[model samples]
Target chain A: MPLEDQLLVERSKKGDREAFEHLVQLYEQKVYTIAYRLMGNHADAADLAQDAFIKIYQALPNFRGDSSFSTWIYHITVNVCRDELRKRQRRPTVSLDDNNSDGNNYTYEIRSTAPGPEEMLDRSETQVMIQQCLDSLNDDYRTILIMREIQELAYEEIAEILGCSLGTVKSRLSRARQALKEKISKQMEPLSPCKRLAK
Target chain B: MRCQDVMELLSPYLDGALATEEREAVRLHVARCPKCSAELEELRACIGMLKELPLIAPPTGFRVGLMEKIDQLPSQQGSSKDKNIFDRVTGIARSSWYRVVAVAAVMAMAVGITSLWEKEGVQFLPLEQKPKGVVAVHEPQKASKEPPVVKEQQPSQVGQSSEPGASGSKSAVNSKGSGVKQPDPQQGNATVPVITEAVKKQVEGYVPKPSTGMAVVSASLRLDVVDIEAALKSVGSIALDNGGTYLGSQDSGSIGIKVPRQSFERVIGALQKLGGVLSYLPTEKDVSVQHQTAKAELERLKAEQGELQTKLTSEPSQELERQLADLNQALLKQIDTMKQLEDRTNHCLINITLQ
Candidate 1:
């Protein structure tokens, strides 16, 4: 941990809100990115990222710093996503037409300085295509892929986070990569078969 | 190897994680086979595309909303047992109904001091057991049943959190995941966390002790209450009085509270009397075997790791390296499981549905 981060963590443990908010400002981007990648939607990404931070705040006292604080927070972000994903699996599927039943029933407040233009710029053809492919994947494949590929977590760390053995992580990550490749191919083949399959 | 065999190793092969022979075999196979080569290429492209996903900002008001949510959270640090007991006594001392008792206790303290000093040889004490003053013994109900004995000198402020088990192990810490100081009486004089026999007996039936397999007990109740809100408040208060936390309504709208294991039945009985009991189910789970197994595994792995460290000093081989890495991962997994087990075995969760 950086000296500043170490100091911030100590102060946060002592219930210093300013120190905690500063800590949040420092990692909000990384934590939000992890949430966005796992959740694949802005609304859920926002909700769950905040949930992750709350969990981080509550679990801060118990943090023995066994792992790097980055790794610790990343693990929390992933776990929050995993739990929500699992709960969604168990939840009854709601129809798209059911407005009230939709998860994001609350109206999004218009920000004076919304990132509409920046988000528009970010949504190039390739980003959307790949995200669509990622969203098409099963929960396990998507989660493992995000952790390994996007978060770039080590296989040992992924294994520890998912509470699986090393062998399981390797095989599952390999399968996830294969699954993602097939999804990407399926998505790309629709746009231009010649370009996709070209040598 | 066949295409299936080659495909299974391609991701790790891309990341340079395969064994040397497997890497070489996959490389040679992909070079020769168009199908395997295309699959490998596609996997590489997919990873590249994933990496291209831009870092997007969170929705507006993310920080403001998060801070607001955090403000509602119970203060974990301030809720230490000492502060809570002090606050409780202070709250009670301020109440009008308790003035007579308070005044009487003040008078009694003035009168008991010389006798108490002579009998107990200057307890060097400010006042209470578990709490920290004369106010604790003023509980007229408890004072009559059990004669007051001076509390043992406290260890450190950090040494106190929850009730200790028979062994005073870290596992004996509360399920709240608070700071658990593993007090060793065998250590120097200052570190003695001596919970006197009398003190242990006082809280024996009420508090959770994380020992004897840490048996967690809980109860679920379905009640026909006249008003849901009142029932919820009553249930929450019951939890508070028993030194537990109310978990509030889950998505299913069931009111939940987590109390100490020993207090599970008492809480259940009290709740049952509140209204017409539609259904009640008490559950108990003993996790001693699981706890013991994880502990043994941790010990064994640590010993093996020590041996490997000694070997690494003499010869640093890849095989030894792999063994050490695997052992560390195993240790991490074991530690996570142990933590979950301790958390579960620490408290009993009661979910009550009001009809």
Candidate 2:
């Protein structure tokens, strides 16, 4: 934990609201990104991130120092996402209808994007295509990829946050990349038959 | 490296987590393996694209907004030092009720003392079987039959009395008399005494001494209920559920009952559901602190009594010996009262006054 975060946590537990504001300002963006990438929506991600902060406030006093504050917050964020996932599973919905659907709904794609960022210009169709490719991934695959790649969490940290073993984190990251690669390749086949044939 | 193995390390490599050795192994293998190399190239492009993905900062004025929200939050009621002082003062205030109860008790006790003091002291004939000192005097209603000793005693003689109320004087005498008589059972084991005897013994200080151990716990709850029976049933059920027997109850107004401490909350919740709870007060009474002090005192008394018994056997001075016996008797009396108080507190008294 940062010295400031540790100090803030101490002060917050003593009911110092100012110290806690410093904490919220520091991590809200990172926390928001994790929620956004996992859920693949602006509003839901924003809501989940806000909810995670509220939980952090409630659970701060009971934090026993077993893990780093980042890791603990990461775990909480992931838990909130998983709960959102399970809720969606319980009551499936058409993904495009409502962006702010009650957490019990999500969308899935048949194929995932290929591995790597094939240099797309900023704000170009390709960039949009790449994001769509990411959206095509299954919840599990997208989550592992986002945590490991975008968030740059270590296998152990990812494992702790997701409540899985290091081996599971490794395997999921592997399959997620493979799935994305296959999806991207399949999407590109019609655009260039020669490229497909050459491969 | 196999496709699966290469794929696992690919995410870590993209994240820059791969150790030098593993990075070398993957780099060396992928260079010759066209398919794996292509996959690695694509993975690299994905990382590049992720890097360029627009950074979405929290909404405008994120920190300012957050700080404003946090500032609006409730602050700590007091600092540690203040809480410490509050706790100490509150503790004293909480237990001060005992002093109030004690004063009332002292006044009630005054009447009994005059009768015990006025009667001729009961002297037992030495038992043939027991030692000469082992005398048992049968004085059934001994204090009760002695008609109002308060009426006959000279006002001036009672605590250097200045007031005309000698009947009330008996109250003061009984209070002192009760205080002193409270330690006799430690003298010897005869027969365990009963009700009036127990009261006299307590007034005189015999067995099952007065307890300072009684714990008073209070709890209240609010619930929506249709009628009084439902509330009564709920309270009864709570007590029954928690292995507590309901002692007493009131219904037309709010209900009140004493329960074991362990049953405190369960009973309170049940009663709360009896009506739409307008207000609630819940508290725990812990006699542990008082019990601990009383036990230490009892232990000291027992040790002193043992020392005096030894002195009574071996010493020769008459005045010294009588003084020792009196000390031994006082300690014994106190020890008994202390034990009774312990029993009372250990019972975990939960008093529920519900609306």
Candidate 3:
């Protein structure tokens, strides 16, 4: 934590509304970005980000600074989005006690916009195509890819956040990367330099 | 190692997480393999695109909305410092969902039986209703050590509410020192001065000095009024009376007004008189630094534009045309900055939120 953030955290913990707003302004951009990436839309992203901050405010008293404030807040953000995704999926909450082999069996039923590679001729902007591909992926793969590639969180940190083992994190990241590659190639074939180079 | 094995290890290899022997094995296989190498590059490019996604800014008034939400919450000085609220809720739900449902079902059955027993004709239980009477008279203790719990559930309305611990004085704000939270807004009349002690302190601490120079000043006032539309119209008329223009509303339940610097104090006073204030924030920025910088940059850009115009007129060339375009871009940007500063210095903006 920076000296300024430490002081602000101290003030916010004491119920200083001004200090708390200052903290919000400091991290709102990154939090909003994470929410936008995970939620894939503006309205839900705004709501999720606000909800994440509200939870953070409610939970600040207990925040003993075990991790850096950013990590804790990002973890909260991820959890909030995960809960929302689960709710939308209407799946039973997976029990942590269950001896699930790799936490990989729980795949969300995404309405795949995944067209075949041959049909991927109408090219969009690279950024737009990439986001579309991300939106088409299963929730588990999308979440893991966002955590690893966008947030750049460490493997150990990712494991701790997902409550999974390190091996699980590594395996999931690999599968997510492969999934994203397939999605992108399905949506953006000619635009993919590697595909053209390989041909 | 076969190509299949190399392909599986490609992701971890990109992250440099593979051990020495395994990394060497994958590396030697990819050295002769084009397909496996292309797969690695493709994944790398995909990750790069994901990383390159631009972060979007939240809509305006996000901070304001969030702060208002926090204000309505129960006292912030909480005791549970070990785990977060989400974790606690999720833990219970995951571990004890069945137990919780069983308890709820049992309670429902008990309620049904009790209602049956209470019926005169349909007596579910046979005996001792009239045999023995144990009347326990409970006294309402006003001086109990525990304070009353105020559930601020609904939208908190402003103005003349019979709020808890409030003197109900019509002077608007609770000028006295009290830390009482507003009673449930779903119920009637939280009609006291609910301007919190912290808010009052902050408002008093910000004493704006008289400014002869151009300065941009603004204030944020939040009131939980019963009628948002009426309050907004009332505030607009008040601003107009003080020679201010209504900037209209950017969002629901909020209005923005711009008043001349001279009547800024009068406008603030009149607006405070409109309803009960939930929170107050006053801010002033001496834009001398900005004004001075903008003015100097504006002058410099104009002079450069003049020079470019002269060059373009004398020499008809593509180079001169390109220079002219570049100068226009810079000149337009400089003017935009200066114009923003001038707009800021013109008047004071009062952001009134009627919730």
Candidate 4:
């Protein structure tokens, strides 16, 4: 833990609301992003992120610094998302329509050197397609994929968060990537034969 | 490497998670094999697309909204230490042993106190000790055989006091002594002392000694407010300003407030100013006896716990250690009850209903 975060956790454990708010500000975006990718919607993601922070605040006192603060937070976020997904499964409410009509407005801004307009448009469409495919996977596979590929967490960290062994993490990540690849490939099958063959 | 082995290692190869030897094997095989190369390239593109997915910025004012929700959480749940205490206290209070013991003890105490007051002809005074105007309603037909003690106390005109207007003092005494049956000590000389001693022992066994006098002040107020939510917020603020807490609100537009005992009246007054007072009922319950009883029990249990601790240190027996553990648990429960009672007495509860 960074000295600043360690101090904040200690103060938060002591019931300092300000300290907790500071901690929330520090990690809210990261936590929200992970939740968004896992949940695939802004509303559920935001709600889950807030819920996770509240849970993290409640569970902070039992935090013994066995893992980094970020790892602990990621663990809590994953659990919150999993629980919400479980609840949705049981209740089976009619989810809102995909509402991807505005998909064109969302462009993937890659960190590499800026691409041309045509390249950017293709990348944006590919990003949205990948997200849709990712959302279609089972909770276990999607969660592992997001934690590894998007959050960029280490295998050890993922294992700790998932409460599995390092070997399990490796196997799960491999399976998750394979599952995602199969989904994307199945979606691309309907496209032109030339595009498919080029790959 | 064969196609199957190459395919199995491709995912890890893309992640750079494979061992160096495995990575080399997959690399060399994919370089020469078009089929395996296509598979690896496809997996790489999928992962790259995932990694390049746009980061969604949280809704605006998320931090503020989260902080507000955190503030709304019960104070006890915000800290693990407080949550532990709350959980343990609720657990003990809900446990069968505690429930049975507490109910039995309270019943026994009530019975003992009633019997004591009857036998000793003790007048139980209200906690406030205020004297009210007496109303005498005559019902001569209901009078039983008057005890000799009563007659002896007013011997001047025993028969002459039969007149309704003249018998005020006698009637008052009769009314006060209505429920008690005075056993004739002379009729059973040998049984009297034994019965009295048995009753005394039973009463003493159940009721712990009372300690300091502490009063719990509670008030209920109904207000006709133009704005219910604003009135509720004002009531909450009043409690906070008076070094207290806004416990919660019910669906019936009633809010529960807790303020320091010393500021109970002040909080009530402030609440009254919030809107037109429709109804206000303020009461004081002297829980001194109950508080003291729990405290005494806690002390006794703690003393026993200390002795058990000493015994364990000297002569370690599994049976003794088990007994010690049970005693310690009981001690913690008693202490929790004492603390709860003390808190209740120190802070007053005010239920405010907004119309």
Candidate 5:
């Protein structure tokens, strides 16, 4: 643990609400980002992030410092997300976006003048397709991929968060990347004609 | 390297998790094999696209919303520790042996209090009266033989002031030196003051400080009521009558009520009158320590905020501005928390469950 975090944890354990609130401020964005990727939606991600912090506050006293505070927090976040997923499975709601075959309409302003509108659209479409593919994977694979590729967490950190060995983390990442590749490739197969014409 | 070998190492190589030798082997093979090289390129493109996915910003007011939720939650110290003690007491109550021990302990306490009250003629005053003083009966010869349990009760006595007379008296000597000497144990007489008048005179030279600790009282009740709505209404009225308000109510026949700490026992008594209580658990948590800790923290933050403000005024840098902003936020949160603790300690919560 960093000396600052250790001090914060000590102060938090001693019922210093400000110390815990500081810890919350420090990790809220990162936690929200991970939750958004895992949950594939903004509202649920925010809910999960709030819940995770509340749980962290309650459980901080018992935090034995066996693992780094970040890892401990990530572990709690993943568990909370998993519990939410399980609950969601019991009473499923149809997502309106699921039927909307049109890609995300949210515009991305390209900073560079190199790419034309058509190329930007294609890239945006591909990005949407990749998200869809990531959503298609099961929670374990998707979580590992998000932690690794997007969040850029180390393998050892991923393993600690996932409660798996380093070898499992490696294999899972490899499998997740392969699965993503397959999905993207399948989505792009129809675009090959458009690609050839664009070329 | 075989094509299959190079293929298995591709992901790790892309991830930079492979050793130098393994990375070199895959590199050399991919350079020689077009199929392996294409696969590696595809893998790299997939990862690159994944990385390019824009980071999602959490909705605005995320921290504010979270802080609100945290504020609504029961403050941390009282709930868990009290729950553990409550659970242990309940557990021990369930076992026969422990129940016997508990009964014995209660009996011993009753006897000790009764004997002391008889000797001192100490009247139990209403909640408003300041504990005048406890008549400390110390026998010099029997001091060494005093039970450790009696010693334990002295601090509680000291914490709660008691006076020497039936009528309220203002004399410090009457309150402080009320300890009477017992000549014989056979007569069951009151004992002498532990400290002699000379010693008390010497001690009187020092200033006396008052106790400022606050106690938080909480109760949880499971009731079998005739009508849930009626019971809830009665509970709400009870709270209102006691200068409290209905904090909230749930559709599931659960209601949260907050009443003044002084009227906590009265509120519980009123609640019991509404229905047959299946379980009534009242706990008093001394959050003086927690309150003091938060006060100290608030003072420290306020000092820091003042220092930061001074620094910002002297050097108008962006870094100082940001730091000041963060410090202000932290200070606000700390003050809010301290205010909440004070409010919570002043009012007791009664979580009533009706069936």
Candidate 6:
């Protein structure tokens, strides 16, 4: 945990509102991205992340210094996102937009001409589809991929976050890498480089 | 350089998570084998692409919004240290400082109130003059420690109201409970109405008709269907066809629905369309007896509140004023719970599971 987070945690234990708020500020993006990877869309991810934060806040007073705050927060977020995924599985699949086959259509593009934001909505949307492809993966595969690639957590740290043996973490990551490779390869076939290379 | 050996090293090499010795071994092996090199490159690209997966930055002010929400939560000071109410009370019991402060506060209030009363020549308040109504119907229900459990069950029961006028205090949530569980509208569609009507008929003769222009109904059912989705659509169409809508649903595949009391049979006929019926859960939950008791208690509280308020104005002692404030708070909490229960019971919550 960062010094700021440690400071916030101490203050929060003493019931300081500002300190808790600062903690939420520091972690919202990281938590949100974890939820986004698992749930696959902006709306569901946002909802899951918010719920996890609420649980984290509620559970803050119970902090026992057993784990780093980041690890604890990650555990809470993954658990929350998992619960959300289960709930979603039970319900009928309803997309907010039906014209697009992919649920990743919910991703908005900032459409700019230069590197600063010039990408077309199509490019942004394709990026969203790639994310959706990532989301369609199984829980074990998705979490390993996200932790290894996006969050860049080491194998040992991931094991701690997931509460699994390091061997299991490594095995899951190997499988996740293979699965993602196959998916991206398949998805990239339509693009120019991949198509030309294939030919 | 067998496939198995290459495979063993692939994960770490692909991740750049390998040690120097392992990295050198894999590098030499891949360099010597075209297939292994191609595989490594592909793995690297795949991992790189996954890393590049467009991270949707959460909406700006996410932290601000989250912090605002955190600030809004009632401080968890009481529950954090103590697991439950018993633990909390025990902690208070064990604390000498808490005991001393509590006793001192009570003594100070008593002396201050007495001196003020003596100075003003105030008379004692008589309880008989308090007005009795729904406000009075609220306390025993509130004090029963029943609200949280009832609130928890409300989502499960909201589809079929077993108790008529049982107000479901669950606000209209787009998702299910306060947990991360999204409110499954599809589940609500399938089970809400069949259970609602069953509860209505159950309460028809057993419960007293509310004198306050309200009705109570209760029913129990076991809906056996092969597919939960098809059942929900069929039941939803039934409610829609009969001019009703779904209220809620349970994980067991039971649904709660609300239809006009007059079209009860139509809703029942619609539910029967939901495929083969197994044994329906019995809605013998007779709130009538409990309802009467709660109504009486609520009336009594209202009367008490009125008496306290009147005494506060007339006698104006600090103790009386504090007591009046306490009574009002209790009364409000009770009313809120009753109103919630009333909403839930108004609709029938049907519990069902498909084999």
- The model with the greatest TM-score is 3
Q: What is the C-alpha lDDT profile of model 2 across B1-355, one tens digit per residue?
A: 6866876687666656688999888888788888777777876665565544544454434455445443343222212222345665565445533344444344335434533554646423222443211111122223233323322242334444334544343443434332222422212111112211222222233343333445645555545566656566677677767777666565453444556656556666666555676666665566666766766675676566556545544442345445544554455456555665654544444444433
What's each prediction's clash count?
A: 2, 37, 11, 0, 5, 58
lDDT of each residue in B4-118, candidate 4, tens digit only: 9788778778878889898988889999999999988888877877877766566656777788787555432312223355675776576554554454345445545755685
In terms of lDDT, model 1 sits at: 0.68
Per-residue CA lDDT of candidate 3, range A137-179, in tens? Answer: 7888888888988788998999999999989998989988888
Candidate 2 chain A: minimum summed lDDT over ten consecutive residues — where? A104-113
* Model 1 regions more than 4 Å off: A90-123, A194-199, B79-355
For B32-98, candidate 3 gives per-residue lDDT tens digits of 8988878878877777778767666666567777887776664444222223667655554564333
Docking class of 6: incorrect
**Who is ahead in lDDT, 1 or 3?**
1
Q: Which residue segments of model 5 deviate by more than 4 Å?
A: A1-11, A63-68, A87-124, A192-199, B19-21, B78-355
What are the root-mean-square deviations of the candidates from the true structure over C-alphas?
A: 28.8, 29.9, 24.7, 27.1, 25.8, 24.6
Candidate 3 off by > 4 Å:
A90-124, A190-199, B78-355
Reference-based TM-score of each model = 0.48, 0.41, 0.50, 0.47, 0.47, 0.46
Consecutive 10-residue window with the lowest summed lDDT within model 1 chain A: A92-101
Clashing pairs in 5: B131-B161, B132-B161, B133-B162, B180-B191, B181-B192
For residue B260, give model 5's deviation from the true position in Å: 37
**Where is model 2 more than 4 Å wrong at Cα?**
A64-66, A90-127, A186-199, B1-27, B60-355
TM-score of chain A of 2: 0.74
Candidate number achieving the greatest DockQ relative to the actual structure: 3
Q: Model 1 clash pairs?
A: B127-B133, B128-B133
> RMSD, model 6, all Cα superposed?
24.6
